[model samples]
Target: MKITREVVQGLYKQTGTARVDTDVAASFQVGDTIQARNINPTGHTRLPRYIRGKKGSIATDNGVFKFADSLAHGAGTQPQHLYSVRFTAQEIWGGEAPAQDSLYIDLWDDYLEPA
Candidate 1:
Protein backbone atom coordinates (compact mmCIF):
# COMPACT_ATOMS: atom_id res chain seq x y z
CA MET A 1 0.00 0.00 0.00
CA LYS A 2 1.26 3.46 -0.84
CA ILE A 3 1.07 6.10 1.87
CA THR A 4 0.34 9.67 0.85
CA ARG A 5 -0.15 13.07 2.43
CA GLU A 6 -3.85 12.51 3.17
CA VAL A 7 -3.29 9.35 5.24
CA VAL A 8 -0.56 11.03 7.24
CA GLN A 9 -2.71 14.05 7.95
CA GLY A 10 -5.67 11.91 8.99
CA LEU A 11 -3.54 9.91 11.42
CA TYR A 12 -2.16 13.05 13.04
CA LYS A 13 -5.69 14.37 13.33
CA GLN A 14 -6.92 11.13 14.93
CA THR A 15 -4.03 10.69 17.33
CA GLY A 16 -2.77 13.75 19.05
CA THR A 17 0.15 13.50 21.44
CA ALA A 18 -0.28 9.73 21.77
CA ARG A 19 -0.50 10.15 25.49
CA VAL A 20 -3.54 8.43 26.94
CA ASP A 21 -5.05 9.92 30.08
CA THR A 22 -6.11 6.81 31.96
CA ASP A 23 -5.22 4.88 35.08
CA VAL A 24 -3.09 1.82 34.49
CA ALA A 25 -0.99 -0.29 36.86
CA ALA A 26 2.75 0.25 36.80
CA SER A 27 4.54 -3.07 37.03
CA PHE A 28 7.77 -1.39 38.07
CA GLN A 29 8.78 1.85 39.76
CA VAL A 30 11.67 4.22 40.12
CA GLY A 31 14.77 2.55 41.56
CA ASP A 32 13.29 -0.88 40.83
CA THR A 33 15.44 -3.28 38.79
CA ILE A 34 14.11 -4.40 35.43
CA GLN A 35 15.27 -6.40 32.45
CA ALA A 36 14.23 -5.66 28.93
CA ARG A 37 12.49 -8.66 27.45
CA ASN A 38 14.39 -10.18 24.53
CA ILE A 39 12.06 -11.07 21.74
CA ASN A 40 12.78 -10.72 18.02
CA PRO A 41 9.35 -9.99 16.72
CA THR A 42 8.67 -10.24 13.01
CA GLY A 43 6.58 -7.09 13.19
CA HIS A 44 6.57 -3.58 14.56
CA THR A 45 8.38 -3.02 17.88
CA ARG A 46 9.50 -0.06 19.96
CA LEU A 47 12.25 -1.90 21.81
CA PRO A 48 15.77 -1.37 20.52
CA ARG A 49 18.00 -4.31 19.75
CA TYR A 50 20.87 -3.13 21.94
CA ILE A 51 18.63 -2.57 24.95
CA ARG A 52 17.12 -6.02 24.89
CA GLY A 53 18.24 -8.45 27.62
CA LYS A 54 20.03 -5.60 29.41
CA LYS A 55 19.24 -4.86 33.03
CA GLY A 56 18.36 -1.37 34.15
CA SER A 57 16.70 0.69 36.86
CA ILE A 58 13.46 2.54 36.41
CA ALA A 59 14.37 6.22 36.38
CA THR A 60 10.97 7.81 35.78
CA ASP A 61 7.32 7.19 34.93
CA ASN A 62 6.28 8.47 31.53
CA GLY A 63 2.65 7.54 32.26
CA VAL A 64 0.12 5.63 30.23
CA PHE A 65 0.42 5.83 26.44
CA LYS A 66 -0.87 3.98 23.43
CA PHE A 67 1.14 0.91 22.45
CA ALA A 68 3.00 1.62 19.20
CA ASP A 69 3.32 -1.92 17.93
CA SER A 70 -0.37 -2.58 18.35
CA LEU A 71 -1.32 0.68 16.73
CA ALA A 72 1.06 0.03 13.83
CA HIS A 73 -0.74 -3.22 13.12
CA GLY A 74 -4.13 -1.48 12.95
CA ALA A 75 -5.01 -2.52 16.51
CA GLY A 76 -6.66 -0.02 18.78
CA THR A 77 -4.72 1.81 21.44
CA GLN A 78 -3.45 -0.38 24.27
CA PRO A 79 -2.58 2.14 26.91
CA GLN A 80 0.07 1.16 29.44
CA HIS A 81 2.63 2.65 31.74
CA LEU A 82 5.83 3.94 30.16
CA TYR A 83 9.11 4.30 32.03
CA SER A 84 12.49 5.88 31.56
CA VAL A 85 14.97 3.19 32.42
CA ARG A 86 18.60 3.83 33.22
CA PHE A 87 21.27 1.37 32.25
CA THR A 88 24.98 1.59 32.86
CA ALA A 89 27.09 1.87 29.72
CA GLN A 90 29.13 -1.00 31.04
CA GLU A 91 26.08 -3.19 31.35
CA ILE A 92 25.25 -2.80 27.69
CA TRP A 93 28.72 -2.45 26.18
CA GLY A 94 30.68 -4.68 28.55
CA GLY A 95 33.42 -3.87 31.07
CA GLU A 96 35.39 -1.82 28.60
CA ALA A 97 32.75 0.89 28.73
CA PRO A 98 33.03 3.63 31.33
CA ALA A 99 31.08 2.97 34.51
CA GLN A 100 30.11 6.61 34.85
CA ASP A 101 28.29 6.66 31.55
CA SER A 102 24.61 5.72 31.48
CA LEU A 103 21.85 5.56 28.92
CA TYR A 104 18.22 6.32 29.52
CA ILE A 105 15.58 4.67 27.38
CA ASP A 106 11.82 4.91 27.47
CA LEU A 107 10.27 1.47 27.58
CA TRP A 108 6.77 0.07 27.90
CA ASP A 109 5.50 -2.31 30.57
CA ASP A 110 5.19 -5.23 28.18
CA TYR A 111 8.87 -4.90 27.24
CA LEU A 112 10.12 -5.22 30.78
CA GLU A 113 10.24 -7.83 33.55
CA PRO A 114 11.61 -7.91 37.08
CA ALA A 115 15.30 -8.58 37.07
Candidate 2:
Protein backbone atom coordinates (compact mmCIF):
# COMPACT_ATOMS: atom_id res chain seq x y z
CA MET A 1 0.00 0.00 0.00
CA LYS A 2 1.09 3.51 -0.79
CA ILE A 3 1.70 5.51 2.38
CA THR A 4 0.37 9.00 1.82
CA ARG A 5 1.82 12.17 3.31
CA GLU A 6 -0.81 12.10 6.04
CA VAL A 7 0.20 8.62 7.05
CA VAL A 8 3.83 9.63 7.20
CA GLN A 9 2.89 12.72 9.22
CA GLY A 10 0.89 10.51 11.56
CA LEU A 11 3.86 8.25 12.12
CA TYR A 12 6.12 11.20 12.68
CA LYS A 13 3.61 12.63 15.17
CA GLN A 14 3.55 9.34 17.04
CA THR A 15 7.33 9.60 17.25
CA GLY A 16 6.86 12.49 19.69
CA THR A 17 4.01 10.97 21.70
CA ALA A 18 6.16 8.20 23.21
CA ARG A 19 8.12 10.71 25.25
CA VAL A 20 11.40 9.32 24.00
CA ASP A 21 14.34 11.57 23.20
CA THR A 22 15.05 11.32 19.49
CA ASP A 23 17.09 14.44 19.19
CA VAL A 24 20.49 13.28 20.38
CA ALA A 25 23.18 15.28 18.58
CA ALA A 26 25.83 13.58 16.50
CA SER A 27 29.10 13.02 18.28
CA PHE A 28 31.34 12.50 15.26
CA GLN A 29 32.03 15.13 12.65
CA VAL A 30 32.79 15.01 8.95
CA GLY A 31 36.24 13.50 8.28
CA ASP A 32 36.47 11.74 11.65
CA THR A 33 37.52 8.13 11.41
CA ILE A 34 34.84 5.66 12.46
CA GLN A 35 34.07 1.98 12.45
CA ALA A 36 30.78 0.21 12.21
CA ARG A 37 29.87 -1.75 15.31
CA ASN A 38 30.26 -5.48 14.85
CA ILE A 39 26.86 -6.36 16.19
CA ASN A 40 24.80 -9.34 15.10
CA PRO A 41 21.15 -8.73 15.77
CA THR A 42 18.64 -11.54 15.19
CA GLY A 43 15.83 -9.19 14.12
CA HIS A 44 15.49 -6.30 11.72
CA THR A 45 18.59 -4.14 11.24
CA ARG A 46 19.82 -1.57 8.74
CA LEU A 47 23.54 -2.22 9.12
CA PRO A 48 24.98 -4.03 6.16
CA ARG A 49 26.85 -7.28 6.84
CA TYR A 50 29.77 -6.35 4.59
CA ILE A 51 30.62 -3.16 6.46
CA ARG A 52 30.73 -4.58 9.96
CA GLY A 53 33.99 -3.89 11.79
CA LYS A 54 35.30 -1.90 8.81
CA LYS A 55 36.92 1.49 9.23
CA GLY A 56 35.72 4.63 7.46
CA SER A 57 35.37 8.40 7.76
CA ILE A 58 32.30 10.55 8.27
CA ALA A 59 31.22 12.34 5.09
CA THR A 60 28.15 14.23 6.33
CA ASP A 61 25.51 14.41 9.04
CA ASN A 62 22.18 13.02 7.86
CA GLY A 63 20.30 14.40 10.84
CA VAL A 64 18.41 12.32 13.41
CA PHE A 65 15.57 9.90 12.93
CA LYS A 66 13.75 7.07 14.69
CA PHE A 67 16.08 4.18 15.48
CA ALA A 68 15.29 1.40 13.07
CA ASP A 69 16.66 -1.32 15.30
CA SER A 70 14.16 -0.48 18.02
CA LEU A 71 11.38 0.51 15.68
CA ALA A 72 11.53 -2.89 13.93
CA HIS A 73 10.92 -4.69 17.20
CA GLY A 74 8.00 -2.55 18.37
CA ALA A 75 10.19 -0.60 20.70
CA GLY A 76 9.90 3.19 21.00
CA THR A 77 11.67 5.32 18.42
CA GLN A 78 14.88 5.89 20.33
CA PRO A 79 16.02 8.54 17.96
CA GLN A 80 19.69 9.26 17.31
CA HIS A 81 21.90 11.07 14.82
CA LEU A 82 22.64 9.58 11.42
CA TYR A 83 25.57 10.12 9.04
CA SER A 84 26.96 9.38 5.65
CA VAL A 85 30.23 7.50 5.97
CA ARG A 86 32.83 7.07 3.28
CA PHE A 87 34.89 3.89 3.04
CA THR A 88 37.52 2.83 0.61
CA ALA A 89 36.59 -0.14 -1.53
CA GLN A 90 39.68 -1.83 -0.16
CA GLU A 91 38.45 -1.41 3.40
CA ILE A 92 35.36 -3.44 2.66
CA TRP A 93 36.69 -5.84 0.04
CA GLY A 94 40.32 -6.21 1.04
CA GLY A 95 42.81 -6.94 -1.75
CA GLU A 96 40.08 -7.68 -4.26
CA ALA A 97 38.92 -4.09 -4.55
CA PRO A 98 40.38 -1.17 -6.47
CA ALA A 99 42.13 1.55 -4.51
CA GLN A 100 40.45 4.33 -6.51
CA ASP A 101 36.90 3.33 -5.64
CA SER A 102 35.00 4.20 -2.46
CA LEU A 103 31.69 3.34 -0.91
CA TYR A 104 29.31 5.68 0.91
CA ILE A 105 26.83 4.45 3.49
CA ASP A 106 24.20 6.12 5.66
CA LEU A 107 24.53 4.83 9.22
CA TRP A 108 23.02 5.64 12.60
CA ASP A 109 24.93 6.80 15.67
CA ASP A 110 24.58 3.48 17.45
CA TYR A 111 26.32 1.74 14.57
CA LEU A 112 29.54 3.73 14.72
CA GLU A 113 32.47 4.32 17.06
CA PRO A 114 35.89 5.96 16.85
CA ALA A 115 38.31 3.86 14.86
Candidate 3:
Protein backbone atom coordinates (compact mmCIF):
# COMPACT_ATOMS: atom_id res chain seq x y z
CA MET A 1 0.00 0.00 0.00
CA LYS A 2 1.27 3.42 -0.94
CA ILE A 3 0.44 6.52 1.05
CA THR A 4 -0.46 9.46 -1.11
CA ARG A 5 0.72 13.00 -0.45
CA GLU A 6 -2.80 13.98 0.47
CA VAL A 7 -2.86 11.44 3.29
CA VAL A 8 0.52 12.52 4.62
CA GLN A 9 -0.56 16.13 4.35
CA GLY A 10 -3.68 15.38 6.34
CA LEU A 11 -1.59 13.73 9.04
CA TYR A 12 0.68 16.74 9.12
CA LYS A 13 -2.31 18.99 9.53
CA GLN A 14 -3.74 16.85 12.30
CA THR A 15 -0.46 16.83 14.17
CA GLY A 16 0.09 20.53 13.63
CA THR A 17 -3.46 21.39 14.71
CA ALA A 18 -3.27 19.17 17.78
CA ARG A 19 -6.14 17.02 16.58
CA VAL A 20 -3.94 14.00 17.35
CA ASP A 21 -1.03 13.74 19.72
CA THR A 22 2.06 11.83 18.70
CA ASP A 23 2.24 10.19 22.12
CA VAL A 24 -1.13 8.56 21.63
CA ALA A 25 -1.20 4.77 21.51
CA ALA A 26 -3.73 3.39 19.06
CA SER A 27 -4.00 0.26 21.15
CA PHE A 28 -4.70 1.10 24.76
CA GLN A 29 -6.99 -1.71 25.91
CA VAL A 30 -7.76 -5.40 25.50
CA GLY A 31 -10.13 -7.38 23.22
CA ASP A 32 -9.80 -4.81 20.44
CA THR A 33 -10.07 -6.81 17.21
CA ILE A 34 -8.41 -5.21 14.18
CA GLN A 35 -8.20 -5.83 10.46
CA ALA A 36 -4.75 -6.33 9.00
CA ARG A 37 -2.98 -7.51 5.86
CA ASN A 38 0.23 -9.46 5.62
CA ILE A 39 2.74 -6.85 4.52
CA ASN A 40 4.73 -9.58 2.84
CA PRO A 41 2.84 -12.79 2.89
CA THR A 42 5.83 -14.29 1.20
CA GLY A 43 8.49 -12.78 3.40
CA HIS A 44 8.43 -11.18 6.88
CA THR A 45 6.40 -8.43 8.53
CA ARG A 46 6.90 -6.38 11.67
CA LEU A 47 3.49 -7.49 12.78
CA PRO A 48 5.47 -9.88 14.92
CA ARG A 49 7.09 -12.62 12.92
CA TYR A 50 5.46 -14.97 15.42
CA ILE A 51 1.89 -14.07 14.43
CA ARG A 52 2.10 -15.48 10.96
CA GLY A 53 -0.23 -18.48 10.95
CA LYS A 54 -1.99 -18.38 14.29
CA LYS A 55 -5.29 -16.77 15.29
CA GLY A 56 -6.45 -15.12 18.50
CA SER A 57 -9.18 -13.03 20.08
CA ILE A 58 -9.23 -9.26 20.52
CA ALA A 59 -8.23 -8.71 24.12
CA THR A 60 -8.64 -4.91 23.99
CA ASP A 61 -11.00 -2.26 22.63
CA ASN A 62 -8.83 0.51 21.31
CA GLY A 63 -10.30 3.49 19.55
CA VAL A 64 -10.39 4.26 15.84
CA PHE A 65 -7.62 2.66 13.75
CA LYS A 66 -4.69 4.47 12.16
CA PHE A 67 -1.64 3.92 10.05
CA ALA A 68 0.94 1.18 10.73
CA ASP A 69 3.54 2.98 8.64
CA SER A 70 5.21 1.29 5.67
CA LEU A 71 8.55 1.41 7.43
CA ALA A 72 7.84 -2.23 8.15
CA HIS A 73 6.59 -2.86 4.65
CA GLY A 74 9.92 -1.82 3.18
CA ALA A 75 8.16 0.97 1.27
CA GLY A 76 8.76 3.74 3.81
CA THR A 77 5.41 5.30 2.90
CA GLN A 78 2.80 6.67 5.26
CA PRO A 79 -0.13 4.49 4.28
CA GLN A 80 -2.69 5.35 6.91
CA HIS A 81 -5.71 3.26 7.79
CA LEU A 82 -7.89 2.11 10.67
CA TYR A 83 -6.94 -0.90 12.82
CA SER A 84 -7.90 -2.17 16.27
CA VAL A 85 -6.62 -5.59 17.29
CA ARG A 86 -5.24 -7.20 20.44
CA PHE A 87 -3.80 -10.68 20.73
CA THR A 88 -2.10 -12.65 23.44
CA ALA A 89 1.63 -13.12 23.17
CA GLN A 90 0.98 -16.80 23.37
CA GLU A 91 -1.46 -16.60 20.53
CA ILE A 92 1.12 -14.99 18.29
CA TRP A 93 4.39 -16.49 19.47
CA GLY A 94 3.11 -19.51 21.29
CA GLY A 95 4.42 -20.95 24.59
CA GLU A 96 7.64 -19.02 24.30
CA ALA A 97 5.86 -15.81 25.38
CA PRO A 98 5.04 -14.94 28.95
CA ALA A 99 1.58 -15.87 30.14
CA GLN A 100 0.94 -12.43 31.54
CA ASP A 101 2.10 -10.46 28.51
CA SER A 102 0.41 -9.90 25.17
CA LEU A 103 1.07 -7.94 22.00
CA TYR A 104 -1.28 -5.28 20.75
CA ILE A 105 -0.42 -4.29 17.23
CA ASP A 106 -2.27 -1.40 15.63
CA LEU A 107 -3.30 -2.81 12.32
CA TRP A 108 -5.29 -1.57 9.31
CA ASP A 109 -8.86 -2.50 8.50
CA ASP A 110 -7.48 -4.91 5.99
CA TYR A 111 -6.51 -7.18 8.92
CA LEU A 112 -9.47 -8.26 11.00
CA GLU A 113 -11.24 -10.47 13.47
CA PRO A 114 -13.43 -13.50 12.96
CA ALA A 115 -16.73 -12.60 11.34
**What TM-score should be assigned to candidate 3?**
0.41
Q: How much is 105 displaced in model 1, in angstroms?
A: 0.6
Kindly give the stretch of ten consecutive residues in candidate 3 with the minimal lDDT sum.
16-25
| Model 1 agreement with the true structure over 27-99: per-residue lDDT tens digits | 9988999999998988899999999999999999999999998898888888999899999999999999998
| Cα TM-score of candidate 2 | 0.79
* Descending-TM-score candidate ranking: 1, 2, 3
What CA RMSD would you report for each candidate?
3.5, 5.3, 9.9
List candidate 1 segments past 4 Å from native: 1-15
Candidate 3 residue runs with Cα over 4 Å from true position: 1-48, 59-81, 113-115
TM agreement with the true structure for every prediction? 0.86, 0.79, 0.41
User: Candidate 3's residue-wise lDDT over 1-115, tens digit each?
Assistant: 6899988888766453212233444332344344343444545344655554445555544443333434455764333333345567776667988988866554543454342
Who wins the TM-score comparison? 1
| Candidate number with greatest lDDT | 1
Q: For candidate 2, lDDT tens digit of each residue in 52-73?
A: 9999999998777788889999
- How accurate locally is residue 73 in candidate 2, as Cα lDDT from 0 to 100? 91
CA lDDT of every candidate = 0.93, 0.88, 0.48
